[model samples]
Target: MEAYLAWVAIDLVIPNPMNPRRDHSIESEQMQEILRSKGWAEAITCYRKGQYYIILSGHRRWHAAKKMNEKEVPVYIVQAPENNAEELDRLGSIQGGQVDWTPYEWAKYTYDIWKNSGKASYSQLANKLGISQSLVGSRIRVYKFYPRIEIEDKLSNGMYSLSMLDYILKWIKRVEKHHFELYQSMGEELIRKQMLKKYENRCFNSKIAIDNIFVTSACSKDILEFLTDINKKLQDCQFELELLKVDNEVDVTQNKLNVKMIIDEIRLIECRTKNEAGNLKEELNKLLKEIELKENQLFDMVEN
Candidate 1:
């Protein structure tokens, strides 16, 4: 495509209406600092449209410039592509080299293109994008199954990764194909949502860990039920914690009775033999350690 470099007025440069990125938050602190100290390391990629240039890439840089109140920014203007497919290909190619798009974003836009292009075949669309047909199919499936905005939001928070989603999708398909009855019982959409929620809450780092845990059983009913049970238990635990916070003096009478019992036991131990005292001290130390560990766990649960 024909291209040229120019210094464009910031006001005249507009964000692409079709840009897959929805979160237009300012650049990171580190990136902003870089802009302050060393301005314009790379030019904004754009194309002219009527009175304004639509950004194809470097959107974050444009945002940083606007936040800094810079009047003008460097831009690399390119010739607009002839068709929608070419434009999308150009957009993907340019953005792929910069800040990564989430899988949901990729899938959404890919689906959009596919739909607008008269519902093109996966192989035909893959040929245009120069990716495998299987990948195109999977992405379309992901787009079809997941709520785009919610998944995008969670993914932006860094708790989830595309690789995890990839494996989760595979697991879902395997369940649908191999364990058809269970899939119908739970529904594919619910399965996807629950798996994603459980994976995030548990803070699992490896997709394989989740896959192996869920798919190991020939009968996945038990495993799926166990996941649902864990979710309920976690909700109940959180609810209990909130209830405890409502009553500061909850179980005070019982606590006092337990303390008195402990004190009486200690007094009896004080009057016992030296060897007995040493053994009691050892047991108390171990018990104290165990209590400390349990207390820490409770604190974590409350905080969560």
Candidate 2:
């Protein structure tokens, strides 16, 4: 591959139509910041076509330069092949550095590579990416999540870690279609929050989690059902608290009645032994004061 650095006009280099990837990539602004701070670490890839140049990769960086009002930007010009389709497909494999492509981006363009090149085998893809077949297979499964655009923004924005993404994709595969669709509609962060709640044990068990997803995830049939479930839980908790309050009131009432009975018996004793009755009445008054304090506490609980 003949390659050389050339400062090309910003307007001359255009995004290739055949490049299968979403251009609403979240990395453009970050790249702009990086270019402003670090001043362009690597040259973008392009090939010449007559007078104009076409970009195979680095669309984000290219757009970032345009935003900065740059007339021309440096690019590594890879010699154009006669058959542009096959060559662009080949070059797509080597586009950008580590963290450039989102999982969805990979799925889209990798599908392009497969289709353009007449559908390569799994081992062929593994060999091309220099990874094991299983990793390639896992990435292919991630393609299924592409239909979920709400997640695309997050996934493209670097919202999830590799291992967490692995677990999420795994969960998507095993979960019921409707539930998974519901989860997809709920936004990525909410699902991530629920996943982390389950991942508190740090096991990342998708199979077991999927089995209990409805209960754990608060899945509901409709708005009425959701509200009904929440209201029912609240009512049950309130009922338990009310039972405790009732028990406390009953104990307090019984103590007050017993104190009354004691006072009556003491009055009768006073008729026979006045001095002993006086000491016993003083002790009974202290006991009655303690019970009154307990009753006040119960009142406070009710008021609150």
Tens-place lDDT digits, model 1, residues 79-159? 976777667767788887677777677877788778768889999999977889977887887777678765776766776
Q: Pick the candidate with the highest TM-score.
A: 1
What's the TM for model 1? 0.57
Residue-wise C-alpha lDDT for candidate 2, range 15-118, written one tens digit per residue = 77766565634567887899999986888778888888888767778888888888888888887856744665555665734336666666666565555556
Index of the highest-lDDT prediction:
1
Q: Indicate the residue-level lDDT of 69 in model 1.
A: 85
CA lDDT of 49 in candidate 2? 85
Give all TM-scores, in the order shown: 0.57, 0.49
Worst 10 residues of 2 by lDDT: 222-231
Model 2 off-target regions past 4 Å? 18-21, 24-30, 33-42, 81-85, 88-90, 96-99, 144-150, 154-205, 208-304
Per-model lDDT? 0.74, 0.63
Q: Model 2: what TM-score?
A: 0.49
